[model samples]
Target chain A: MPSTTATTRRALLRTGAAGALAATVPASPRAQGPARGEPLRVGVMTDLSGPFAGAGSQPLFWGAEVAIELFNERGGVDGRPVQAVTADSQSKADVAINEAERLLGQEGLEVVTGIYSSAHAVPLSGRFEQARKIMWITSAISTAVLKDRNLRYVFRPTVHSDQYGEASVSFIHEHAQSKLGTPPERVRLAAIYEDGPYGTGVAAAIEANAKARNMPLVLKEGYSASAPDLSTLVTKLRRERPDVILHTGYNPDITLFLRQAKAGGLRFKALIGHGAGYAQIDRLTEAFGNDVNYVYNVDPVGTQMLDWSKLGPGVGDLAKVFVERYQAKHRVRDLPAHASMGFNNTWIFLEHVLKPAVRKTGGMSAEALREAALAVDIPVGGTIQGYGVKFAAPGTPMSGQNERAFPVVMQFENARGRVVWPTAIASAPPVLPLPPSSPYAARS
Target chain B: MDPFLLEALVNGVLLGGVFALPVLGLNLVFGVVDVIWLCYAELVMVGMYAVWFLYTQAGWPLPLAFAACLPFVAALGVLLHVLVVRPLLRAPPINQVLATGGVLFVLQGVATLVFSTDFRSLGVEMPPMEVGEVFVSGTKLAAFLAALAGAAALWAFLKFTYVGTAIRAIARDREVMPLMGVDPRRIYLITSAVGGTLAGFAACLLVVQLDVHPFVGLSFGPITFMICVMGGLGNMLGGFLAAFLMGLIVSVGGFWWNTEMSYVVAFVFFIAVMFLRPQGLFAR
Candidate 1:
């Protein structure tokens, strides 16, 4: 073998010195094992045993787990298998903070992700920022978490609550006159939301955007998502007779609203829902059947519901892999948006951020990962979800948010979502106002 | 009254009717057994699950599913009383309350394990009916009527039936009932069974109006307790009337304010009632 005086980038890579960050060890020519003694460690913090389980955290974990498994199969990130240390948030902020500190201080992991609740995300971002570690959040809709805080190490690739309001209001703005035969100014709007961070954040955006556009927001009401009776709220809506109802709520509350609205003869031209419970199409179909068909929801497009052919090459196959792995483990084929979010966001962090960190920076340190994440600029259809990955530069307004990331308004048809907004990737045209068959359609 | 206020008032009555059944059941249990089943809402949760499972998963007719839910929960009530309350009948009140509270978690956990946290609705709803200027939900109206019928039947049972007489007599004086050829244990068991039956009835009504999940009990549990306490724990008619008062407060208050503020108003009213009439509005 020949000896070299200096170590070049190519030489360092050829010698498998890519694990130069920490825990470095001698490597074989084939690079069979991790260059470091241990694999790349990441923390998956989510609610596993509390109210946020099942729908929120469990799916988030499952999707991330599938991604970890697939990444390991793909010879791992930078030839080192990714290892995930999961801590159940238990859906409590105090517990989440404690677990996060343990993960950062005790476990000494450089990165932690997968927080389902916005409340946890908001508090934990401060923790991660102070620690100078990366918190690649997969899902947390509230804009307050990162709107203008300008934290250095936090990045969220998923849609935010503000965007939900933007998407919904803009969709109506685009269609108000074209389809409703009524101008945006003439449309009587109402806002009803669950009194949680998620619902409240989205509702605030709706009010702001509506006011900006000079829309007549006749009613804005907040209610408990777990309220046993929404009849009083239903009666209020009936009397107001708003042309458009912008609603944001969680699982049971959405069901309650729809059922009561149907029974209270609450008529409306349209009811636009912002994610959360609205994302669960199959469950809504189970409860309302065809009644859920025309109702629209604002959220990131489901990976399976996207036009995969238009996306980057191999995106379709990757989505297929995720679904297959998800079904094999969960024994159910119904994939909620949260699961896809867990998988896609984790996968994005791995491919767009982590790989580049190792390949370009020659290390996977927190600083290197942040640099790599900031450099990511996947345009529309670059990811499986049909949205791109491009984080807003650090220290800017909405810093670390994926400026390219946007939610679409989807109409549920036969328990399947069809993108109906943002004409470029939309699968179908927006259905303005509910059809006559809809129980909630305005009284003619 | 304004149309919206009239609708709110009508909705309050419907809401009251739904709250009535569980209140009566808890009252019956407390009156005869003199032991509060803190897990009363949990029992109703289990009954809701039973009806949902029998109707949706078991593919039974809706009526048959409801029919099965009553006895199944009644039997569960018997089991609960025998396994937990019976042993602690002579124990400290706090201990009994703690034990039942523990069972509340057990039921929620088991339900989560089996049914997951997904909301399972009955998928049953009827169109609203026009009443002059107001619109009323058919499902709520139906549930309200059923709750009233259930309460009337409970009243008739307490007044007429031999077992029912023994139950009321035990409520009046436990020591005398045992001395006068009545087995207190049997009457207590029967009271628990009746409580369970009422829970089952409430379950059927709730499943139609709300979604069934492990934590469904949390939605109505606090309000049920508040109403029972406001009505004088063991007083059935008092609890029945208190349910309507609370319901009206919730409904009309919501009309005056927001749903959340209305709840605050209702809770404040409950606290005021507690301070003013600790023995309850209809207490003897």
Candidate 2:
């Protein structure tokens, strides 16, 4: 009787252990309906709140929604539907890392995309690399994430600061120098930037590019991002009297500096900026009225400026679709750069890698999805800063540069930003010697 | 290097005076009441918004806007003191801090929700008056002059007035002050009002020199706290001296080193002062 009882107890223990194992294991398949598998999960992290809320996040979500719908209509990635889980990073790096961890670890998301700011992407690069998950940076421009860190899982689909800065200098050389009837030497340049990585990095690149092209950078000024006043700096700029001024600043700072410069009778022959801030066409119109006529800056990828009707395959009619959907839902005008970025970045993920991987695996695993994304060879051929997309080797100058496209220089004319450089993608002629009514000319 | 350093120091001193002027009432109230005015920064924010609303929305002149904001902010201050600070005074320091902090958040939320966080620069622009290597704009000069005058006026009011003496006494001991024939509550209300008015004066200078943002209040609050503590918590004269020193440090340090580290050094100074001389450099 004791031997029999011991044997039964051992059998019961094995049974209980087997049951627990089954409970912990994910349920495999249902026989009847669609292919026996789970939906492919893609995580999108965006700047939902904070300073870059509207400009950096809205479009990404919209683009994802559009792609998700299109992919589902064609029968989901593989036979399983595509699911997206988006979280707000609030433009913070730490929050971004935490969200990426949750999506990868808890939700078991196969692929991730869409960090808005470089600040958010820089730190999260490590988390994604450790998990061996794909991180498609849609809007962030900081190069340090891929360049300094050698993050294998990271790939950037958007233009980096260097490209933008270089483009601006090129635009100045091509448009301003000849138009002003001045040699490169006569065209002295001054650059004033905000004291963050974005501003500092861009300013350094602009200076380098200008020097490479034999353009003298007469004045270099770094001002605090949250400085209460720029009057002292503006006064100094006036005294230096550079022929051209390139400012890497946010909207408020840009407007404030111009107002102060005008008051101080400071003048520059021309002014240009990288596309990070001061790209709001409408806000500039409202603030300065016709003063925005010839003040040129590299423009953000706003769909309104793109030729949506002529877009190539996989690019879709983004400009029209964005405007229509955005207007219908938010009752707002054209989608802003932030909104445009948000939407396009999400679409790139769904079309480029998500759908293809789901088809291959009959289901999505984080590892499989990352492999599929690496194999993707599509060009980001949209009107919003057209570029070829691919990843750089984890440790290379081309690592972040691999999948990123260079931003085209665009000019702001009549309070509207239109692509004007890289003659192939050029949409319009450059605007030289900003309008007389502009604060630039008035200060001069 | 020395010439630019000297120039930068002068500039910092001038700017520091402007930064300190608005913070005086806040420091005074904190020293006397033992209540950290979490809304102290918001006081300045509100003052700025009030000026903007009066000047732009209400179609008033610059001077009118400045004048109108003082009483308006003062009233708001008294109301805030009664609603938020008064009830929480006897609570734990953490609770007092939290209650005032709540007021700060509410004010920030309301401002952003209503006005939006766009930068509203004053329309009037003035030219800078350049002297050799030293460049000072008309607005900066005006801000410096106003800050000086305001500081002097407040000093006189505190030194010569009966109410000012009562306020200082109340700050030291609120319950015992009533036995000395001072109504602690009335003094609290009046002191709160004075704090708001000084914030208003700072706001006017801010609009003249810089653009106003709904979130600008947060940027300056901790710096003011540092100044107050570094100046000797209850000593107004100490606050002035610390403000000038802070100004010199920011301007010169910014020029000589990375401009971004100006505040970092100031914060380090704060920590050093807190540890080495908790009573502050000018403590009696």
Could you say which candidate leads in TM-score? 1
Off by over 4 Å in 1: A1-39, A48-57, A90-110, A130-133, A327-334, A354-377, B175-181
Q: Is the docking of candidate 2 incorrect, acceptable, medium or high quality?
A: incorrect
Per-residue lDDT, model 2, residue B4, is 45
- Model 1: reference contacts kept, as a fraction: 0.69
- Model 1, C-alpha of B224: deviation from truth (Å): 1.2
Residue A351 error, candidate 2, Å: 2.3
After best superposition, candidate 2 residue A182: deviation in angstroms?
Answer: 3.0
- TM-score against truth, every candidate: 0.90, 0.82
lDDT of 2 by residue, A1-444 (tens): 323432343334335433532332324433332322365667767654334443324445555555454444444554565555766664446667766787888878766878766767777777777877778777777656666666666777667788767888887777655677777656788888886667777888889989898888877878765565454565556556787888887655676676666555577777777655566555555556666666666644566667765566535454565567666754544445655665665566676666676667755666666666678665656433345567665457646444555666666765667777776677877656665766567333
